[model samples]
Target: MLDFTNASKLKKIEVNYQYDKFSWDHPGSSAQLIRDGKPKDAGMVEAPLNEIDQVIQNAFNQKVMPGAVVSVTRKGITVKEQAYGYAYRYLDDQFTEADQPILMKQDTIFDIASISKIFTTIAAMQLYEKGKFQLDDPVAKYIPEFAENGKENVTIRQLMTHTSGFEQGIELYKMRASREERLKAVLKHSLANPPGSKYTYSDLNMITLGVLVERMTGQRLDEYVKQYITDPLGMKDTMYNPDIYLQPRIAATEYQPWTGRGIVWGQVHDENAWALDGVAGHAGVFSTAHDLTILGQMFLNDGKYGKALILKPSTVKLMEQNMNQAFPGNDHGLGFDLNQGWYMDGLTDVNTIGHTGYTGTSLVISPKNKAIVILLTNRVHPTRNTESINQTRRLVARQAADAIPVAIPGNKNAWFAGYGDQKNAILQAKVNIQKPSVLSFLTWYRMEEGSDIGNVEISLDGTTWNELGFFTGASDQWQEQSYQIPEGTKFIRFRYTTDSTVNERGWYVLQPQIKTDQKNIAPEFTSTDWELRNR
Candidate 1:
């Protein structure tokens, strides 16, 4: 029901904002810099309609579980929806794209494993937007039973951010006798670490939230989710429990060894949630790529889908704000994983939000970029022993990011400078200086293995170098160092050498400048500053 006209106007404005932020060099020209090959023009780089199809064909071609479905959207328009592989490989019935196989159709339902947390999170935020609850409100307020075992102080915000200090996981299916007992066990369990000390992604946080929603609304979590989110957003296929008629369209999950649940198909694969009747806040929602796209767009639209405000714009903003500041790389927002380099490849760092399901599903949304990448694969089928589909997820998301031509044509992908593996061989970058001029060079560096003996050197040429300084190498501590280049230097170079063996991942560079006179400003020095140095 959204007005595409208004959305289009808003998208144009947003694109301009991003273009400025990224300092994109051209309007509508973008390139994907292949390490060893010529940069490909993203606008013309054609592959399969769905980027995941390409990945599936490459990595998961031999796997079972029928097929895979992937979809990507930008500014409310779906750019791709592709299916590959089999919906039921062993079945004698030949499958085609038209058949809508259990795992292959555009609308085929998927047990989105932990992706259900996003729905629960949005539902909770909706209640908050309606003034039904406060983010800081203690869970004990709605579910008094949750206050037991020193958990009276656990706030809703903590649960959403996975900072409640609950244990990573609990096998409710094996430990508890019944659903009621499982619920009781969750409420009675104590914290593994002090609350809010650090992020330990836990299912208990959301399980408790599910209980809170049920207790407050006098409705099951699934019912509340349907009435508030799915129904209003017109996501007809998303639900915690599907009818028998829909089972044939659902993809298979795991072959559990302990729960006696053989080859879980058309049922929630999580053992703990399965014990709780497939309706927990952390997991157990079944949906399709199309249905999930609606939710993705809602977040991209800042919580308004059509006329209904499922969540306040402010609440959605808070969900995208990083809460794991103390823990640097483990970027997390309220109920959303963020700034994940491995999964959110090529997306804006601060503006993108996404989460991955254990069942090989991932959703990456970049509101600022008006982009969404959804890859749904049942890599857990036949077995859950596979290491991780992170590479595939990253590749697909990067492909989507690459597809969006940067407003500027020649801007290079952001640089990721890190220490090389060779302890004795120092990483170096050289900049050529043609004429005598006063130059300012800026360097950003951080040490992975904090060491007091780490030092940097600047060289006029490859033979002789001058020591910049020494600093204790500490993880995640980025220090900016600047210097002035002396006149008459033919070339300048930087070397990060360590007296003691230690690892580091940071950057060194020369800042760009605007020339006052109409003379050609020779390109600056430093490895990252050079256009085509090492390659």
Candidate 2:
């Protein structure tokens, strides 16, 4: 009976992929799989990341580097395993002396830069499900020297959706050439536009798809991603360079005194994947926040794990859908980067996929909350010009998206729209309404569309306001709203206008009625940035 009603296997997994088209909706609710220490054997709920461990110990007490390692998982339980501050605190790049360092643990080790292009786009979709080619086949159909220059029409789905305008890497370590002449100058680099037209986040398109998966598997792209993706998912500490006895739980990154490679611990820190010898499919990998949460639980199990399937839950639901609809907010997916509320903050929806790593990492998976949220950091340990781990990657993805709980209807009270950043929230009421009134309730929202919203105003004079509707998309569930309160309306509200970006699971209101013409007003309300919780 474990079919779990597959809902026709999620409608054969992606027929024009529509998880409600995108205002966010996914896993909506269902997680159970944690064993022993039991998140009640998986009815899930443990996520107390003590404000994500005090925002990674206040960004390592404002030094911003010197260590971090976080892990989280929701549905399959292991809630949050943390560790912060110095995985090998300085002995060079002059973080001045104290080299007895080594504390951040729950399994240290992380370079994870460019999240190694989604493990080389999941080892080229496990070799496009072993049929080998045709993702619109074209990087000159398996590197015929990548069709020199005009890039012979770039494809493999526009290099897994960075939209292939290619121009983000090839600095092949200040070019003294040879790494096959900087990979043939990234196959004759030129087009920074016009190749699926826009979005250009390239590392020479995954170092030419890791030399077209080492020329379609003559081996070596780290031995075909450790023999078919991390030794069939066991991920023994994730790889791509680990010889020198894992160097005391490896962490440190950047201290490269002009490529004389001063202090980059345990190798691989993206000097164009350490000049290509470190296995580059765009940044040499090195993992461990629970070995990248077992590859984000094999992408929330769409690609199976335990009995190891590799890929194909309709190609892992086409790698989380949104293939750059003409680059709208760059929500890629194929190498996963969908719904990025700037580092998946408040866990931006569209089926939440993730990837971030230029030394200070990020992973976030949330496959509709079958969740995962990594966050590995060395922030650039000794030095890479710190400042900007994008606010601890949006505060550990808004504390694992405010520990996922917004849906308080029958379990009691509601009316909460409180997240932060350039905020403004409301909940006012003073209705005497001498004539027409209707206002029933039960609303929901998820802002950040053309810059946040959630309004439902009206006023007579408690400060002139007017629009009685507007809640920017992403209902993902609740809805039963109404409004029409004209005649003598004394005032009524529910505002919530933000813009300092990324907020979801924010707006909600519940069971409020109000058929007033005078008597049944049921007023008694007046709040700001809104809340009346019973969470």
Best-performing candidate as measured by TM-score: 1
Q: Write the per-residue lDDT of candidate 1 for residues 1-535, one digit (tens) a residue.
A: 1111211110011111142112213333321111111113213233423444666677564443346788877666676777765443322212223333343677778889899999888877777777878888888888887888888998999999999889898878887487778988999898988878888899999998888777778898998998999998888888887887886787766667587766677789888889998899899999988888888877766666665557666787899999889887777898999877567765636667999898889899887567678988777766676646776776677677656543221232222233332333343444544443333323333343343234444456567665544444322222234334443344444334433322323333334221222443534333442232110
Q: After superposition, how far is residue 269 of candidate 2 from its true place, in Å?
A: 8.0
**Cα deviation in Å at residue 315, candidate 2?**
38
- The predictions' CA RMSDs to the true structure, in order, are 11.4, 20.0
Backbone clashes for every candidate come to 10, 3
Clashing pairs in 1: 25-408, 26-407, 26-408, 26-409, 27-407, 66-86, 66-87, 67-86, 431-525, 450-473
- Candidate 2 per-residue C-alpha lDDT over 1-535 given as tens digits, one digit per residue, 9 for 90 to 100: 1111211110111111112111212334222223224443433335535678888888877887778878777665676777777777776676775637777787887878888889898898888888989788888867777777687888988988878777776577788866777777787777767789889888788888888887888887888888888888888988998888988888877778777878878999778778877888887888788767877877776766666667766888888899898778888888778888877877788778888887888898877667788888888878878788888888788876666666455777777877787778778878767776677676656677757788777788878787766778566666776666767778788778878757665677776667665544456667856767654
The TM-score measured for candidate 1 stands at 0.73
lDDT score at residue 201, model 1, on the 0-100 scale = 90
Model 1's alpha-carbon lDDT is 0.65
Off by over 4 Å in 1: 1-53, 61-67, 90-103, 409-435, 438-535
TM-scores, each model vs. reference: 0.73, 0.35
lDDT of 2: 0.75
Local error of candidate 2 at 520, Å? 2.0
